[model samples]
Target: MKRIKFLYLVIGLTIFLGCSKEEITSIGQQGDYITNFDFPTIEIFAPAKVGLTNRSKNADKFLWEFSGAKTITPQGDTISYSQSEKMVPDSAFYELPGEYNVKLTTWKDGEQKEITKKIVVEKQQPVIVVPENIGVFLEVTFAARVFQFPGRPVSYEWDFGPAGTSTAANPKVTFTTEGPQLVKLTVNDGDETLSTEVVIIVQGELAKTIYFTDAFTRRIYKYKLTTQSESQVEWIGATTGYNAFGLSVKGNKLYLSETGFGTRFSAGDAAIADGVLKSYNLDGSGENIITKPVAASLDYRDDPWMHTVDRFGNIWWTCRNWGVRVINASSSEAAYPAIKFNINATIAGEGVSTYFASDIKEVGNEIWVSYAGTTGKGIYKYGYDGNYIGKFTTAIQSHAIRTFVVDQVNSHIYFATNRADAGHGLGIYRADMDGSNIISVDTHWSMNIGSGGYSDQGAAGEYVYITNMDIDVDEDGKGYLYYGYRAISDIYGSGNPPTLGPSAANSGVKRYNLDGSETASFLFKGYAPYGLAIDQVKR
Candidate 1:
């Protein structure tokens, strides 16, 4: 009977609960706790002064009271907090990053408002700094933010891609080879790890190129000295007009001048072509034809040769039969006023024809010119305006100099004697610019006995190079002066040193000590080369 009574009580409770396993409480326990809201925020890296854009930021401070509510921070981490009178952190300074909560409260006329926000701080990633491009044997400094940040962990690793790996946070790397290199950096802060990666280009040694217009190749080419790695055998651009002869290099730009020797240049093409000066990119792109019109000089040459630019960017050029002339190449238009300088203007001798010049150079505030064949003084110094200032060297008359270049070190002129006779000519000659000390750098026998080629010469630092292309053929491509250099031999076949003929043997660029001893030699099959310009890349 007692069991039946307990069962009835259980049934009554079940009817009230209605199949739900929920606690049934009296109204006295309800509405006892206050409700709260959430406002979470997040940020990254450093400079951690985060700002909160609150709509009620302009509310009167007197109506709101501030306090830091229940704080839940990561273990062993401490955070600095600054609060305003409105109950919000003025500067969100989370020194140690982790998950935590911050609160804001507001009161107006006895009305209260409250907010609870969760703030998450992530580990700052390391920033790496290195050269985007570097040459061989160059010292590259690697830097990282992890090494500079205040209070950063001492544990860090650095990997310089294929260069090598290092335990240091900051390392200096030098590449022996050339190519793209990948770099990685990692840092640890006891609780978290941050990583960063970047790619660095360790470029190889800039190609050792001789930029020149080969009358034989009939195209301007950049011949490489190192190897087959960084060079092109044939690189031609749109014909401003074929049978062109000289190119000037400034920075990465090339200025090629076409001499309308026209039918005079080639026999089959009877059409008279106009001489044009055009500008091209280093790799031979962007042909900008420069058409500056000027009345032909009353007394001299018209076709242009190698040109030079002044500090103010003025184009000073030399012509075949004409004296030195100036053109304002600074304008963008294809036309410019050509100013012809008086050829009789001279301080040395009145008979000097300024029009007969080659290799026009502007060094400092002065302009210098080199003359070929049996013309006026071999080299002449002049004012920028073509007024002869003085004589550089006596007439380059007898030697029949094929080409001449200046020694960067002093006022010495290095000229090449182009006569075919072995004993009297076909040698390298250097003399003071003022016609003072004349010395035979390499005689005909010296060339035939060594590397049997002699055409052009260039000097840089402590070394001088000879471009050995004996000119036995005409400038029309079949010239022996093309590249008739063979190995240097003390004995020429039989008795004494006999002069070799064209097609006998040939070589390319030969490097020699200041004393004319062959230190090294680079051999090429055949080339129509003139003048050597060593371009040092400026990073």
Candidate 2:
């Protein structure tokens, strides 16, 4: 019985030992054991000294102790233990830059760990310098140097203060206008940014000669009749945009046609009369809308676009809707009363087409009007009295006509016409005062220069210069002709079925001897050199 009791006791003891072992194993699996501890160490240097204060991490509680001037006990994970209070060291120390170290201790469970880190801080920010106050002249080019901190990715932004801005590390910028400008630059570091500013004064100067091309941007430029290469020019703005036809000069005044207000359709509402005659002073100041006449009732398409100033300073213009109207400049309101005469009624022709009147010379005592049209293609000479003196057929397709010069010395009338079967190439035709002896000089030879090709005409001494469909020429008294060949494209016909291939190059003004031999060809500056007026302004 005693032996049985001993065995039972041994079994009970074994079960008790197994239960304790299982409890200890479960506790280990639950991560209750003391493992490891870690802390971050720091080092600092200022002008060259370091301070320390006790810091710890992962501890249920913290106890910080520092060695140096004072002992500090910080309760947080991080503490600044430094001897000096300044963040950066001064550069006054020429040789040795000081270094410092910081110790950090951490406790977790029953384990503890410590670490140290070193840091060095420099004094003062980087410097950027530029030359002292420099004055730059307007529109003048100059150079300058730029300085900045070394060993850094320096970014620069220059604010020229004159509204000019740039991003050049070291750049040369030119000032075109006069004013006080504030120049500034900015440099950026990964962690910080710096900027500097300078005041710059720019002086102004006079601009050179102004250029006047066609009615681009609706601005009119007037040039003085002088030979100074750099003469100053003035710009005048038009109330209504100027068309491609250009301006006409008579005496000391100028005359231009303003196709009033753009519209969407032919029968749209009249926005201040479809056509207006504008007059300007010689100095480009006293600009006045001289005439506004509703000559017709057909929605005034503003089509038959042509304007000329007669010797009496009166303006004569034609319109697709308005047959023909004459403006009396001498009148208080510049009245334009329709010309009442046989030609105005008989040939009252719709789309009166192209017409030209001389700038009023004393010879004929009557304002001679030359007109042509597609419906009834003929050149008619009308007297100022509104009487049709005579009419004659010059060419089958004489859709338009322009007077080159009415030579009172020779009683000869010179004009240009687009008379081809297709009405493309224009021809230079001449006739006597009575409309006889009409002849056509094939201006384009056999090439297609197309309509709207006739450019300009002028008289320099006895030689009369005529610009035709694709050529320019000067007619000598003895039947001698000089021609300038030019290349021109007809944009009006570009949409025809299939393409007209590329526009041919029979363009560029070419000069020819009166006998039709090629002379020197003077190329113009741009394409479609349509409105060719001699800049008699000596330059």
What do the candidate models score in CA lDDT, each in turn? 0.47, 0.39
Question: What are the TM-scores, per candidate, against the unseen true structure?
Answer: 0.68, 0.41
Model 1 per-residue lDDT tens digits across residues 1-539: 11110010101111244577654321122332232323323243333434443433222231221222122235733344445442233335444445556555554435566666665554455678675557766777787765233555567788876678787756788776777777788877565577889877777554544555543434666554443245454555533443354556667666665655331212232223245676777677887766533443321145555566667666776655545566655444455344455443442555544333555677668886655533343555788666667654343434444456554444456665544322345556666755556666555434333444342221111011222221112223221112223333211232111222343235333343333344334435454333334333332
Error of 1 at 84 (Å): 2.5
What tens digits encode model 2's per-residue C-alpha lDDT throughout 59-157?
442323223212223342223343322111111111122343334444556576555554333322333344433323323322333222335565666
- All predictions: root-mean-square deviation over Cα? 16.2, 25.8
The weakest ten consecutive residues by lDDT in model 2 span 4-13
What count of clashes does model 1 give? 24
